[model samples]
Target chain A: MVMRGLVCLLICLNVVGVCHDVSAGMYDEEEGAFETVSALNSDHRFWDDVRLTLSHVYAYGTSESGAIANRSSLRYEFDTTFFKRFSLRLDGRSSLYWKQDHQAGVDDTNALAQNDLRECYIQAGFDAVSFKAGKQVVVWGETDGDVINDVISPRDEREFVFTNLEDARLGQPMVSMDLYSPWGDVFVFVTLDPKVNETPAPGTRYFRGPAGIRVENEKPDTSDQESGIKWKKIFHQFDLSVMAARLRQNTGVLVYDHSDTYKKKYPSYWFYGMGARYATGSLLFTLDASLKRHYQLQTVDISGRYAGSECLMTDNALGVEYDAGGRYTLNAELTHRHIVNDQDDLAGVKQDTDGLFIQYRRLFLNDTLTCQYRFYHQFQEGHTIHNGELDYLFSDHIRVIMDYTFFRERNQRSYYWTYRNDDRISCEIRYYF
Target chain B: MKKTALICLIMVAFASAAAAGQAREIMEKVDNRNDGQTVIAHVSLTTFRYMTQNGKTRAMEQARIKRMTFVKKDEGPREKDHKSVSILREPKSEQGIGFLQYDYEEVGKETDQWMYLSALGKVKRIVAGNDNEPKTGSYFGSEFNYEDMEAYNLDDFTYTLLGPETYRDTDCWVIEAVPVLRKAKKSNYSRQILWIDKDRDMILKAVLFNRNGKKTKIIMSGNIETLDGILVPRKIVVDNVESRRRTVLLYETIVLNRPVDDEFLRVRTLTDKGYRERKLQEFKDLK
Candidate 1:
């Protein structure tokens, strides 16, 4: 559909010479170069432009769970512009995952292959107003290092190689509208997914899905529509955002357990977040507070009617981040999670974690030489996970990266399913045209 | 009735004379003009800037500049000059020199300018009266524009001579010049009053008013010296009224048509870095 539309716009522009306004002054020393190449010089009508991109990625990692994996992905993107107001883009990615058997006794899959649509959207804009419908990535933060790709749901980026989470879905069909005003902007989005299927474990479900339960029959009685509204405003040098959402199904819970003691069944989950960001000169600061209700604890099978089903759980997090000079950044966060139900076989639970992260970077010799160091210490319950990374930029677009991960604590063995000390190193070269 | 009319006429004549006297002092003393066949000078400037916030003064070294100019005939119903300068720092950095030539086509009517920059190695001709593009633009770190050098017509302004006064021991006329064009280009001042020495018509001091009628800039010219029989001010001081900013220019040497070869302004000379270095050394070694 996007390709056809682009072609039609080009044909119309060729019939009319009205598209010059869009390219005027785009080239400082020349006039009509773009028009001469385009078919729109005779009559005045519309304008159009087309661009394409190709990218590839590779990654390798060893998990304490006795699994070694290698992953690769390739992506293609095409963008079309028309009338300087209409834009349509199509993007897709294909991935391959390979894993080695663990030293510990365990049966693991060798390799996996997957393909998914990243973005396929038809968008139109007039001055300050724009509309986009279809599958697209929703980005919300401003800082590149700590904020750029931090939130939102499309697919679990490593789902293909990460067997335990391989079923995680990527894109969803949605309609989004953005309004731009001088003072600020507002965005509204609504997503519809009628074909509901099997639910995943609690704490592991998708953004709008109920804790691991298809609940197809229950959805009809509830609000199955998913919609959210966000308002963003600039105050002084800070950018502030307030967002709210309503979902027909419980979105935050995964697996639920009910003991034979009580015959009870209920939906698990709710999600909410509010954040503020400030950037001045070389300093950046951000604060985020989020809440999750009826969080998943441990689920038990009921004795009678609810025998085959499980319960859901939730948690809350208050986070803050500070970055100095764009070279180094630090983040501190606290989270409190609780299980909703109480039964003879199921008990309420609460877990709290505090984390601190720091990183430093420097570029010398006219940016021809570079170095970086990062450290993160996360304390949960009685356990701590410390991670560090160092990188060097050898050229304008090439870099060598090395990372180290360590886990320490008296209860470390029981804290995480897989905890270990490891080191990794890689080199990459990037080019843009 | 006739007696009263005679008295009124006498009062008007006195008021006019006083006003003219003030205007004459501002121009004739501080800003001395209309003298000599041609005068040239090389000037270097050193600026010290200070700002006061919360009852504390913070001072710092701001900028340095070097310039050369040649003032010529303004008596033959025309005003023209041969001027050139080499900027040594940020505002108007040029690896080489820039030349400026001005010619008054007709009295009170028009003027023309031809500027040649060694970097471009070509001369650009610009119309006169529109000094906005050349003078009002940023030059080096200090604020000085082409318009800042021109002798604007006094008739275009409404003058109020503030009585005869001796400024720095120079008897002067203090007159104000207000623009008739409300939207004149490159003018940040709403009103400007100058103090001119009565003896030489040289401007000595000036006070600039902003759009809000508040004082914005205070300027003083000093170090009176005669070069080639023409009295010239050797030093200039500018103080930003609203800012803790100030600039000072000191003339290093003054000469009248000391003789410059046309070869120095040629395009080939600009491309020859070796020649430029040699020429610069020779200019410095001049007696």
Candidate 2:
């Protein structure tokens, strides 16, 4: 009942947002003149390069309790450019859920399955400066399938990593400006309201803790603000960038208040990061490093006990990509993270962690079909995730995709081991116009 | 006999000097005719792939459209640098895709290329084996590759006057260009033969040979039109002899020496549709 109310509220908000934008459009003098000129002089219209895509996805998987679950979703995206210098985009999705048995303790139906507004943004550009305002996503970093320095935006972890990382990213309401110059491109962003990553709710199948354990979420006030700046430049065969930001961390740690209850607290922190890429011949090398001050996280012990802690953390990653031939590519990356100035025992807390990622892709049939495999492993915990996908484009506007993912852990007490039994296979078809 | 030998030596020396002078003069004319400070063109490309099925010939076609902007500047007395951006506009799947290139005429320097993938909304730097290697899949699966689109650098190849001939009713100077040792290691073609129009100072046709001395590709340029004091080919066709595939590029509009802002060449323009379209509008009417 509560989820349905939220859905209805979002619908009403969307309607109001559309009406406001349409009313605001009438006051833009420059855009109006530009549209008139375009219509009079050329075949070009104010609305150009409009694109729409419809997609359907289906997945069948078994939970840890041996209950079979089926999930289906329909998604749509609409994008169009207007007045030569402005664009508007929208995306939404609806889904259906089913389970073989209601006795498995998981809900057989989801009331909020059809409620999602993925992205809505308006973009405009001038001679040297460009602006984008509304709900949008800004991505930073070069490594594939790994998060080392990409911390600017929040993410949705409700479905875990099964969804494409790009798709799982939730847009934040922000206004951003990019100033282009020969020396470098500088970006400034101001977010109106801070947003944290959304993890699975307490009653969902993906929830990690024991059932009946109450989970309390403590979010920052809507008035809280966040901002960031990034400067990127390209010199000869090298690309480099540096960024600094003050924002609340997307993922919060859980603190066990007592035996049967936990509290999730989101804390704000400062992050400084730098990244570089150099290309030579068919090989490209990348490096990224970031330092976070006053990082807060929860650590889990072997006995499932959780404790909260705060410390400074440093993360560094190096990656390389090689094109073997016309149809094959290989990529690998190594990341190391360490906690600084740690004074507590924090037995379950990950004071140090190292991870390696490898990926291989091959294309066939004039690049109409692509097959890819990716593997990620954490050194200390012996946790590994393997993913493979095959994508085929049947035509210019239609594509089919199939993917499988598996998670494993050598240490049964590790955090990743909690999902070892939830491997899944999914297929999707997309039509673009 | 001694007098005769001296005379022969003098004649041979004169011929060698004349050949070298002629080659340099022809290259200078070719360069002068094609060089421009800035150029923008809107083009339509059609690719045809032929196959023999059941002893009958079959053909398949693919079409693409793009707008290209090029800028060249003299960096030094002997050095030239160029930057070009090509944005794809047709074939909905490839719409908004873009390629940016930086080429330097200095020896031992490699060209740089970056590709903007619209689907990913990201710009990726392309690193090939050499300047001659294709940046992507044969320039949209056509017979032409990325290297084929680059303007020729006189210093990279040694030219020989193959003599005068008439091709398609036009008087032409046949020239053969062989890559220098340093360039041969990076080049895909062992030698290229050009049919330069004697009057227009443009290459009318070209034949490329592989390292094994086998014919690999042939390109023909036609429908020459003078625009802004420069001869521009309205139509260009490239045929791959090995695969029996061909690509034809038709220039719908050609604008030379147009004012192009430096901001239009930045990475942001490639990723931002509005920025790219706005910049392109500056030259859209050239057609």
Candidate 3:
């Protein structure tokens, strides 16, 4: 029994049970998981662990005077245990995109709806070791936004930088093994099917290639499966990790194959990376660097199109985060990419590109509202992108997110020049059950 | 007359020091209470807004509930040094999120914490940051801040005993604790008055004053039970007087003195979902 001042809590916890979050499956330290599902929470349904969310998204172009996106989506996710040591997880999403007003591009032949099974994996955990297999995503990096050393899973950049980070990754079939030892933890992953980044289509606003140019995708060498291994350890306030992988690049390298044809080829590259993080009080510093061997580059050829060139390059990102364990936070990172062997001029590529990125976030109203702003600038091309977002929770099961994005360019040779008129404002509302 | 006044001031000082000494001794016993070396608890956190009319307090219609399995163990040589791991089990949007923290007892030392977001599939090291001022963020969006959940250091505050009284039908000693200079700089409260149960040496109720010297919060502990020969407070209610908010933390079940592996409290527990789940299952199986 609570004190007189807390008498309301007793009724809220027992008879009322108004909170929706407490109505589902809850852990029990005594009667175990399933037993508690049957006894408390009062919902003895079979889908006790299943979670579903429905959302609608709309984006209006600020420059093109048209609608950029109108989409409705449903997401379903759940995890359940079948044995004492093994469990299964299934996550999937279905989306429907309605026809929108033309905004410098068209999607006449695109599918109106699609379904994707993001992750369907099974895991078996034992003392000191664990194994997971099936379709999954394995992330590798220390930097928050810079994708310097995160080379494992292929990304879906169909929406440029507007897609949520959680939804930008495309899971691949793989098997991972983890071993936890006294010194550190070791991770190993092998890919059964390798995939490339999903880029914008021919008629899309983000596409830059010449129109009506026939495109062909080259399949990777099935015999040579993509794989990687990582070793990580923490000492005091410092965390260190080293990783290496022999895999195919996710971004397709374009090469002109005569007769108005361009073949999208993904070449095999060897990646070696190391990352470190150190924290002192409210400051956290991160450094991630990687070197790629036989990296594929696009070189201007005699045909005035593009040809593939094998070269070496290095990618590095240095980031600092000031969280203050509070509602206000600041994060900044500097990224640099250099082509060590750039004797051959790579078309539309700078030999050394450096970029600056910064983000600030603040929460209000007991974390029910969040406001964030992000800015990124590429020094070589003098191009910049700014994004401002506001997220508010109307209730435990509903949330609304609004975002505004803008891009600036000083020259026509920058990547953003192709879609410079694509600045837009977007809003999404989601309900969870 | 001057000599007598000085003597009277000295005697008053001596009496105040004696009261302080007595209060410290009592607080020491409260700190040394047998809480067990290892603890596995299922915590249910409920946060809501409320308004008071007359003397009745009614919770608002909207409330948020969060549930997690929390495990803690004393590790380092220091008596107050320990490591803890918590994994959220309810709330579909927050499921699969976990936190690992290693708390240090040494004054001025910082705690090391890591958080893992399943959606990101990354384990990130976070800081107990201070930007000119201490963090005022609530813990899990509840009225309790990170400070309220941490293990206390006796040196941080000076206690003064204010005689004894009967509170809630139990004999209790009223003590006023004021933060020392060093702690005052980082603390949110200027003063705290606690009602200590004379028999159990536990804090039964506390009323805190904000830095502005205004009444801010009231914390009351009830539903006490003896588990494994040790008294434990199963329910705690924190009422934020300023915001008219309330948070109730209920330990649905707590199993103490269980053997917990050190690795279970490591970073692996935050990132390795399968392993963490296995360990959590084992902990739930503990009687």
Candidate 4:
């Protein structure tokens, strides 16, 4: 019954503008004129790029429990020019979700409503230099589904890989400047509010802990700002970039208290990374590597030994993308990580680990229909994940998407094995205006 | 008698040389006349798909609005390169979509293309061996392909002056162009015949022949006007003979030699909505 009401509400909101305009002018002339003028002046030519999107998603686990999750969201984006050289943009989303009970005690009914301001920024260009301020997202890597050099922006991992990577990115408040030159572009950024990745709630299926334990996040002070610099250039046939930053460690150290609660403490770290892309004919090759050093609790081990340790980690990834004719693309990446100064007694902080990711996409029917398949394999943990998606455009304003995700593990010790039974299928309908 | 014959032979040789020289000169004039440092334009495209059912003719129409900018650079004495970006503005579903292209005038050099999809919020580089591939999606289901919209370079083809002709009550120079060996290996068309308006120094009509020497397409341009001392075509129609499809492009506004900032042509403009809008506004204000 609640689902029916929500559906009706969404439909009404889709056509509310037309209904409002018709009813406003039905019986009054002066009132209609006043409304029209107000609308015209409010939505001036400068606001012509405003856009809105509404989507409803239904997801269900393919298990005996038959858990279902329904979500609806409305997103709005506006972009325009203020002065002659300055540009301003705003984007926001409002979402609602309802999850059905999987078991008697697992109600999973909390924080059903949410609102987020994704990005709001203003930028100006002056000859060879440009400056941008406000909340924004900055990505720094070329590999797909890899996080080596792309650690600048935080992510919302509540839904894990089920969510689009770009959508999962959370913006940070920052000021950035770019200096353009013939050789390359030099960029510097200072972030005031650096957000940490949001993990799944304690009671959720993706949560990783015992039932009685609670998690508390301790964000750093606002005065502890992060800074980064990047230099990017296209030389010959290669696109190259190098960056260095001082950042708050994304995965904080977990300190367990007497009451079975864990406090997440974020520490400061230094990161340096570099990446390059070279394209030849229909194939593109990419390489990225980054090094980070910090102190953190060794959370990966089942045994609670080496709980606190200072270590340096290096991650490197090599990827290739091949484009076959007829709107088909394939991408593959292999990543390797190495840790230094690890405690010998700890089982979690392995000296070396590797991961591989692959993705394929094909478009049909004049690009109105799209199909994609992706696979991720963690070699050290022997865990694999498979995701497939189908999207069809019903018209210019409406689209339908279906997705299925599966996980497999060689052993129960792998982290992904915790959700081996959480395989799910999802369907979504979207309207654009 | 021998002396007179010798003189006649020399005269014939001089005349043939003059004809060849004139052809090259005319081609150079066409090239120089069409080249512009920077150009910005707003265009409306309407495509008509024709079908026959039970001896009845029916047509389906699709409309689109786009803003395009083209910038050129001289690579060397014989080579030039062009960078062009097209942003889709209308049909709200496809809004914020953009295409960026880098075209090199030298034969055998591949053209680079990238598409920015706003829904995915990512820019995808399209890697293709040649620009003649039909997989570019036919310009929104129109008869015009990406190669048809590309700027022509004189060095890629060899042109021959057919003769002086009159087309549609206007005097024109008929010329036939065959792709060079390097270009022919990648091009789908065997030859193209152009009807150039002598007075305006612009192409008014063109007929394209497939690799099999069959007439495949016809393009007609009208509504000629001059902007910034350059001849511009306000309207164009392309008819595909095989598919019986037609595409019409109407230019709402055309500005040439505009003060377009080099930064506006960067890849960031394709992915950054605010930057794209600001650059577009600057281009519009120029008009």
| Cα-based lDDT for every prediction | 0.44, 0.71, 0.79, 0.71
In candidate 4, which residue ranges exceed 4 Å CA deviation? A1-46, A63-67, A98-111, A222-224, A295-297, A300-308, A342-345, B1-29, B52-58, B61-79, B107-143, B159-176, B209-217, B240-246, B271-287
Residue B6 of model 1 has an lDDT of 96
**After TM-score superposition, what is the CA distance of residue B156 in candidate 1 from its true location, in Å?**
34
Judged by DockQ cut-offs, the docking class of candidate 4 is incorrect
Write one digit per residue (lDDT tens) for candidate 1, span B1-287: 99999999999999887776656545534333644443434444434356656644344432333333232333343333332424231112232344343333233343333344432333332323222312233233353434455545544455667667877767876677776562233355678887777777777788888766899777777657676567766666666657546555554555554445444433223322333334443444321
For model 1 the TM-score comes to: 0.42
Better of 3 and 4 by lDDT: 3
lDDT of 4 at A44: 33
Write down the TM-score for model 2.
Answer: 0.83
Best of the candidates, DockQ: 3
User: Of models 1 and 4, which has the larger TM-score?
Assistant: 4
The residue pairs that clash in candidate 4, if any, are none
Evaluated at residue B88, the lDDT of candidate 1 is 30
Candidate 3 lDDT by residue in tens digits, A1-433: 1122233432343344334543221221111111222123322245646778777777888998777777777899877766778878888999877566222236463337778888899999888888999998888889966778889888888788888888888888999999989788899999978877888776665667667778899877786489999999999899999999998888877788879889988988999999999998789999999999998887777767778888789999999998855868899999999998756557656789899999999989988789999999989888899999999876666668999999898878776787788899998877666
* CA lDDT, candidate 3, residue B229: 91
Rank by DockQ (best first): 3, 2, 4, 1
Best of the two (2, 3) by TM-score: 3
Which is superior by DockQ, 2 or 3?
A: 3
lDDT value, residue A419 of candidate 2? 84
Listed per prediction, chain B TM-scores read 0.67, 0.86, 0.95, 0.83
